[model samples]
Target: MQTDNSYANTFATDSDAELVLPSHPAQAREPQWLAFNAELAGQLGIPESLHTTAAGLGLYSGTELPDWIQPVALGYAGHQFANFVPRLGDGRALLLTEIIAPDGERFDLQLKGSGTTPFSRGGDGKAPLGPVMREFLVSEAMHALGVPTTRALAAVVTGDWVQRDEAQPGAIITRVAKSHLRIGTAQFVAHKITQGADESLRQAFADYVIARHYPLSKDRKHPYRALLRQIIDQQAHTVALWMSLGFVHGVMNTDNMTLSGETIDYGPCAFMENYDPNAVFSAIDRAGRYAYQNQPGIALWNLARLAEAWLPLLAKSGESQQQLIEAATELVHEFPIRYEAYYDQKMAFKLGLNSVTAETQALTRDWLSLLQDHALDYTQSFRQLADTLETNVEHFEKMQSWAAWQQRWHKLLTLQGDSDAVVSARMRQHNPAVIPRNHWVEAAIKQTVASGDLTIFNELTQVLRTPYDVVPLELSRYAEPAAPEKRVTRTFCGT
Candidate 1:
């Protein structure tokens, strides 16, 4: 890896001292490399020599660190489910270092499941191999699908066991992100300010966020308000992309919500197969708070919490606190409008429309309603629709009310004056032919844990890299939805 001392502790400051604590990763008993994202490493200018050698394993697994590397555990607070917790930080992860890519993009290099920190909350900071694999695969898959997300750099076995129900093999994963700043981080600062800490802390943190993530906001008349709007726009677009791709981020807690608008935690996340809007896969979400269709609303809720955290800053120049609150509330309300626009545009593209209009929006909604009504596979339905446009095949012949919908769809394309071939090509570009199917992910993990084989895992990752492309014969199984008995109805937070 290239050295850039200037990028060290990019979020650190005297006022931010209390927000971060110096930490070191626990040494692994016998660290063994399991998976390394060579492609990502190359993109980030990480030399193959480093990753191929023991030096890479040691650095990534937290068994060792270079002198310039300053590892720290970030502190924050968050709302878990819907209840607010005043202190929830990086309990199992440390920001190892920051790397600047060849394209001049800065990224945080963090080690998850490395060891315990002050915020460990009396729990072991080790991650099981299953969640490690899940995050490594799914995060990369999300990146491949062109969604803004943190990417996995590597995974390794810690050569030590961690107890979670039964004794499970411990592992660690290296996560790369633009920054790990979250809504909880702001909440923590707000709490401090409320407790009569130096008001400068809030200003410093806000300045840092604007300078780093929302630099353009610094030029605005009301920079704090602009910052909130920009963050809302980013989150709305990101969550819309998640919904368009049938992704359900099971744990939509405030702490897991990144201010950078990147998808953070992959625990309990699953791609929706059957097109039920009420899908709930996270084992811990008994109430289905973060279900498939509830994501946009939950995202709005999280943004409200973020706005609340920024009350002091947003009110810095308002005529009255009530005025500032009202202003923030109005800004927060733009979330749904922006979310709906984004969702409509993406859904229209999936249905072979160049842009969203009233007609296109109606068509998209009707299509989703049909899918939900029939319990059809979400991803495959759109993919097969694209294929139907091209091949003129009766793939959806058994679907109820399909003939009527097809006639309407054809009429719209004919009205638009686009060739069926061109329309089909457009749809294929948006509707993915594959997703990181839950059953296959579990199967890959099962293989790795039972016999230490990575063939299935490697193959699945490859197929996910080109999700929108046509599936070749050998990789066809990856594109197929899981059989009835093999369906993975529940996903767990492997903490």
Candidate 2:
């Protein structure tokens, strides 16, 4: 019985994935050489503590893949999608150690796309280089966008390859998150209920979550229920954050949904270019189950699955269970109002209004409608509106209703004592100067991978990092809408 580095540390070993790498040493250096992954600024300062192992760098860095960093099989079950799966651990992942930062915040270092585990389900447990790079690029972009999300620490193209879609080489990506516990993990143990054992599991799960993410709520009597509410709030804000920025988490499975409320499982995710609202990119989502518009609903549905797992903790007459169901359902019910309020509030702020009022609601809709009607780019439209409102009268006049909107906006400014500079400055912060536009991402991907060019990727990343900054040189190129012919309708999952 070999205990891994994780077990040796304060953390317990839970799951393991196979060690796989890309076939070409030169190919693996795809990112740093071309895109140049900025060495990942360590805002958390947590990873520095880990006894660094050989997670080979571009092509292959001297980092020896540590021998004792054994794979740990994690235990958990969940309702995958809608089906009740009794067992589903890390099918292709292993828990690396938990690093406690100087600030006392603990973060998990997991090796995904590493190798197969007991749960690989006869599929190749290895990940291709493309997905690894994609996740790395997108996750960093998400972090910069100010969304609560799991971050990618580093990507290594192991000097190994595994056959998948024409024998592509394998790669390893290091994913860091605040916590690895998901709704599925709670359900896995709860499903093992022998009589009143379910209640015991919920109690344990609640204690675990409260201790980690919501420590302040641990002593409460119904701590589990409270944890659910906290998760609900975070998830509501998270999904709103996604929508406001046109992000689409193509797969929102219960197992993929993290209790920490940070977005995870970027298996099939993309951002909308044309704002279909119901746009989906995952190849598997034929029924549009996880569309952009449906994220909040699917989120509530996932929460229901979690509530069902905790039902055993309720009571004998099933009366306690019913109350628990109501509690969970009420939170789910709160999703729409909460989501709408957030979206409207954000949209209001973007439109330079203090809050969502009847006047502002109409103004906001008119703006979106104008963009949609002209097939104007979603991000650019909002961002440019702020700049145009401030400087260019001709550009503002061409947008038909802007003059009237400006007048009404002025009236509302009276509500805030309307100082032009103050209002312009506030709106600029609300509207980002740049976003990971689909076309821009695709172009960068092509330049870096196809043409072996680093300029586009470097420029995009530089501009993306300071989304709110208005650097004239970077802003014009970064903020411009994609050419009509270049607009990408659908993005593919980088499997």
Candidate 3:
């Protein structure tokens, strides 16, 4: 791997030393590649020779690195499941390096499940093969689905076992992201300043964040406040996309949310097969705190926490704490309105409406109610709806309420003066025929672990690459919902 690029070492050399702790990845005993994202590698201009070379495997698998490369475990604090943990950071992940693409975009190349860190917090830092595969498949699937998310670079299994419920095969996944900075990172610095650390630390950290993610904020009169507003807008857009796709993030803790606006943590996340607002798949989310419908609220709550972390920086020289709080609160309150605007626009297209209006909003509400009441598959129902529009097929004929909603949708399309074919085409563009279904993910993980068979895993990844396309006959099973007996009701963080 080439390490001499001009911008390759920017984060390592430029970020405030106080923000990151230098660390080393535990060398794997028998590192082996389980999967490599050749497409992503090509996009990054990685040499083809590096794809399967022993030296390349060592670098990505946390077994070996060039002497010049200095990995660090980032430090941050977060609210995990509404409880404020003052210090929670990258327990098993290490930032190996940063890559600046040929197009001038920068991405962090991090090795998750690498080894112990100062922030490991007494737990084993090794990740099991199951979660490694889970993140790799689901994150890549999210990218194909057009959800902003961190991409998987590679998957590797160390011929070592880590105890988690039982001894499981240890593994690592190379994650690619715009940046790994999170709201929790700011929270750490703000907390440090509150506890007698120099105020300049906060300023330095904030400036780094603005420079990396929101450079335009620097020109604003109140740059800190502008940064808060930008993060709020990003969270709104990302969460709205999640809602549109029936994805329950399962954990909306401030730490899991990225300043870059991409979905970061994939632990315990799942797609809702049945359109139930109360749907939650995380085994640990016992209270339904991060349910499918509750995601928007949780997103706003997390942003509020980020705003709280920025109070010191947001304050003017002579501003009182209360004044600063009120100012930040005002900006945080913009989240719901912004979220609704994004959600409505996406939903409008999903229903074959070219634009959102009061009429379309009302129609959407009823359509959701129908789905929830009938427990319709969230993804398939939309694809089926498009078919109904084109063929007058009455896919939901068995339900009495279906006819009324169908008639209303058809009439609205007619009044709006868009042809059925045109509207249906638009709907297909917005609604995907496939998602990373929990059962499929589980089966793939199980098969790979039990027998080292990647046939199912590889095929599933290929089908997900074109989720918006009509399902071909050979891939029909991938587009279908899980069978009742095979349904996976709960997902785990798999730390």
Candidate 4:
């Protein structure tokens, strides 16, 4: 497999590492089967020959690290559901190597559920089959839906079982991302500063992040502040897209928030069925802190944590400490405005508007209000809006609430001077015809675990690849919401 040992060559240390620790050797039990992502592997410049068999996959999940690969378990700190955890690192995940694509783009090739590392705390560092497959499906689905996310490269059955609640098959997912740097990574460096580490440590980590993800920052006058602004912008756009698709990330912990702006961890995440602003599906999120509507605010909060970590670095750049703090604080405060702008544009497109105005915003708000009041399916409501606009005139001449909303939408379209064809096309592009429904996901997981049948899993993956397209009527079952008895109300973390 193609590899770049740049990270190890640049950052390895004997005692006081800036970010990662030496990976503890752990064995993958009876590595039996492997599945490679041909598409993603090709994108990362992996030759077709390297990914065709179990041996190729073994290079990533195997007990022995190849000469070109140096596995390291990273260190970080995070606020979990608003509670600060001083240290939370790659407990069960390890960065194997960086892959340099033909086009010069670099990506991290990491293994989740590989085995325990020093940061594994007191728990066994292994992943069950169900969560592994969940990530494979959802991450691929998110990519297909045009959301920024960590893509899955391969999945392997380790021929072992992990006892979560009961003995379940253990598996490993090979995840690929632009980088693994997170807000918590910055927090870890900041914490080190308080523990008597010199400013050089923080600067080294920050420079590494800039080189890896934001190389352009090196050209800016205030590169550190520029990096912060760039990260904030990426996150703002990412969270807006998540909201547009009704995706609840479930856990918006600082550790899970990547500086690369990709959706990293997928544990307990779900798509909203009924349109409630406060929708949450994580089993552990009893307080609804990372609910659907709360995501933007929580993202800002996470970015604030990142800003806190970078303050010292910014101050060391010849700027007065207080000046740097005020500047960083101002940049963070721009997140809300940036998030709203992206969200407003997306909402306008969903409403089939050529332009967003005060009236359009009000109309969008009222439409959401209608959906929440009636507990309407979030995806279908917008997906069906274009159809409802035409059908209301023929079937519901009496003007029901939906029909009235349609009239207002049509008037707004007229005001914008966009033809029906133009507006309909815009709406279809923004609103998906289907999503990875919670119940369908649960059903697929149950079928795979209980019967070793991958029929449902394969079919669901295929359907979600073209989520915005109208599927065949025979496959319409995939688009439908869950039956009352089959609905999955809550989701759990893989750990």
**Model 4 over residues 394-490: C-alpha lDDT tens digits?**
3233424766776787788888898777878888988988888988888888897887788887888888888889977867898998877888989
**Reference-based lDDT, residue 34, model 1:** 90
Scored against the true structure, residue 246 in model 3 reaches a CA lDDT of: 93
Residue 336 of model 1 has an lDDT of 99
Q: What is the per-residue lDDT of model 1 for residues 9-110, given as tens digits with 9 covering 90 to 100?
A: 444554444587777899999999899988899999987766857889988888878787888888889999999998888999998877888898778899
lDDT of 3 by residue, 78-124 (tens): 88888888788789999877776777677888899999998899978
Name the runs in model 4 displaced over 4 angstroms: 63-65, 316-322, 393-400
Q: Cα miss at 46, model 2 (Å)?
A: 5.6
Candidate number with the higher TM-score (1 or 2): 1
Determine the backbone clash count of candidate 3: 0
Q: Each model's TM-score?
A: 0.97, 0.83, 0.96, 0.95
Residue 469 in model 1: lDDT: 90
What is the RMSD of candidate 2?
5.2
Candidate 4, 472: how far from true, in Å? 2.7
* Sort by lDDT, top down from the best: 1, 3, 4, 2
lDDT of each: 0.88, 0.65, 0.86, 0.84
- The true-structure Cα RMSD of candidate 1 reads 1.7
TM-score of 2: 0.83
The residue-by-residue lDDT of candidate 2 on 53-128, one tens digit each, is 3333421221334454434545566665577777777766666556565566777657666556666668555676
